[model samples]
Target: MEYPGGTREGGLPRVLSDPARLAALEASGMIGSAPEQVFDDLTRLAVSVTGAAISAITFVGETRTYWKSVPHLPYTGVENWQNGVGESFCYFAVGADGPFIVEDAAKDPRTAGHQAIGPWGVGAWAGFPIVTTDGHAIGTMCVIDAGPRQWKPQELETLAVLARAVGNEINLRISLSTAQRALSTAQSALAVSQDLARSLQDSLLPPVLRPVPGLDAAARYLPATGDVEVVGDFYDLFHTRGPWWTALMGDVCGKGTEAAKVTALARYTLRADAGDHLSPAEVLDRLNTAMLAQRAPRYLTAVQATFRATPAGAAGRLCLAGHPPALIRRAGGRVQQAGVPGSLLGIMPTIRLTDVRFRLAPGDLLFLYTDGACEARADPHSPLPHRPIFDEEALAQALADTHGLDAAATNTHIAEVLAGHHGGWASDDTALLSLRVPPNP
Candidate 1:
């Protein structure tokens, strides 16, 4: 119920030199294990919201610890959150009743000697030890920050809440796993699940962006948080019948594979039908007609824009339907949204949209994105959600700032800025596409 500060007992103190820490953990534990899918999902959920580099579940078995899901780390993909006796922070992460945290692991004597903390420069950690409803130290739902930090109490509480939920999920996973084993003990199923998610995601995106005549095209698409495979947002570039290189970016308001499907539909439909419509406005109109035939009733938004990179440089037309407008940087020192973006694709009846015409003479840059690029938070419980939004002025500043970066460089810079502002992943799937007119020959 509580949202991040204060100790459970005011005077318990931060020192682990007390017998109470032992007594508290020795009491009845918290959850049970269930199936692999649910276990994998919760492990991902823990790392995501916490803005940590790693999130995983560790089962402290008689021999050693095993990871249910290890999402990210300071190293390569061939590892999990495994540790030996008294080696992992979880060994000392036990709490008698609820959850506990190590805001700065290097500062804590008991865990400072641990490998996951000492040599790795790991300084901040929030751990919620999960126990079977009875008395088993099943695992912990925790976040690991590479550097030291002053963590608020509410953050630990949220981790505890998620850890408890993880308990339920563990039990669910164990149950599901039992049934899964009954049918087949193929551990490969997990790999398959991961594969399908990856395929669905990759297939939805435009893997290769064809080269335009004069402008350098660049883009980046990031997946959603945690283990979920498919992202609800998509972006792509299509070489039409003429010199025009049509590009589209959009987001499905919801989550999961279903949204991914819708996003793919939007990306391609804009390509296949935009040629028939010719202008950005007509393209969106036709898009709405295509989307209205689908099932989801809410915010199905998209931005359809076309760029023609010629010998002298590039020019384009952009139309918006309930999506954020394009960020445009002029040759001089000015920046602005490319045009007046309209409503989302399906929110209203059939209406004519206005197309914003633009010409990128030699150094002009254009950027299009979903809200996820701008809206994300680091310390989720801050007084105000610390997510970043590129309001007109800020967008202009970003564009102006990118005067020296090439198309790809500028695109990367924007991504780094967004990630730095709100941690990572932008709370949702992020799709970004940029076009920069090269210097006149």
Candidate 2:
């Protein structure tokens, strides 16, 4: 089998020579590397195809003495440069820039007297230079047979065709090396971004909301979804001036730094204004004013409420902004959402806040959460929409299902239920705050 250049020289045995096959190989280029890689690959393949003990690919120019793929050559890398380029068959390949096969190099005038050839006892030598697309003889793909060889036209031609492939392969190697470095850099950047987001999200949560007396309060804030960078959802519980302690929970429209800012603003505003109003409704009204005044990145949906606790462990005045009504279960075991909703804070400044007058009797509980709870989903398409609302019925049932749950258990239940609802995925940041009103002494 023969392609365009010349026949192949046989040293070991077999049939890698065929014109149709050479065409196929030439068209189907080397991948994952630069042009120079093509030559290197050709040299290695030549060693296997020709059954030669040694093979090399040499680039002309500054790398004249360099053997690209010397399989059985001793001490061969780019640095073994104690000899002249004229002493090598690798140099002759550069002159031919194609197949240059010698059955016995010891008697060949071009290499017979070569210093390294005599010392190394090199006899049979065959090689071809790899030419670049620009027609420069950049490198050679060659094979060294220790003994003599019967030359075959098909074999030598196959070697030449393979040399062409090596040119492209060399280019591919360069490209691959460059691409690998780029990919590594991108992955590192992504990891760092994730780490920073997690740090920021954690820092957004206040270390201590302090403690509200007589109220066994505990809260958990988690990302709505897999994005560790999530922000904008939070819960706050602290002693607000006098006999009144304010507890407010809210979420922004979106997730990230913008949302985080709004959350911080809302929490601080509630704490500052909690003592200003004796009624829960008044507290929300003030918060509404605050939200409208700030020009943030986006609008927000939030629930801000103040609970006046009695020594009996019940809330005296409960004011709520636009948000889910509270779920209350008395010691007697009856449960209901302290139905109160005026409007969502932040969206409107002159929002009307509703106040539910009630006492959180001893041994009662309050369930607070972001929309990720009631509307949480388990399946993206499990006979439910993405944001399924818990409504009044669902909320009551959830509380009843986990009645008298301690801080850890209650939060865990909430997380699992939310996860289950979303098909094991909370599409947004889900937050849960559960408190059990202590029994009266």
Residue lDDT tens for model 2, 285-402? 7767777778656555555456666766756656556566667766665777764777777765566666777667777877777776666545555666656554457656766777
**Clashes per model (N, Cα, C within 3 A):** 26, 49
What are the lDDT figures for the candidates, one per model? 0.66, 0.64
Which ranges of candidate 1 are over 4 A from the true structure?
1-191, 296-298, 381-392
| Candidate number with greatest TM-score | 2
Candidate 1's residue-wise lDDT over 106-188, tens digit each?
Answer: 66764565676665457787777675544444456677788877666666666778788866654565556567776674557
C-alpha displacement of 126 in model 2, angstroms? 9.9
At residue 269, candidate 1 shows an lDDT of 75
Error of 1 at 325 (Å): 1.4
RMSD of 2: 9.5
- TM per prediction: 0.55, 0.69
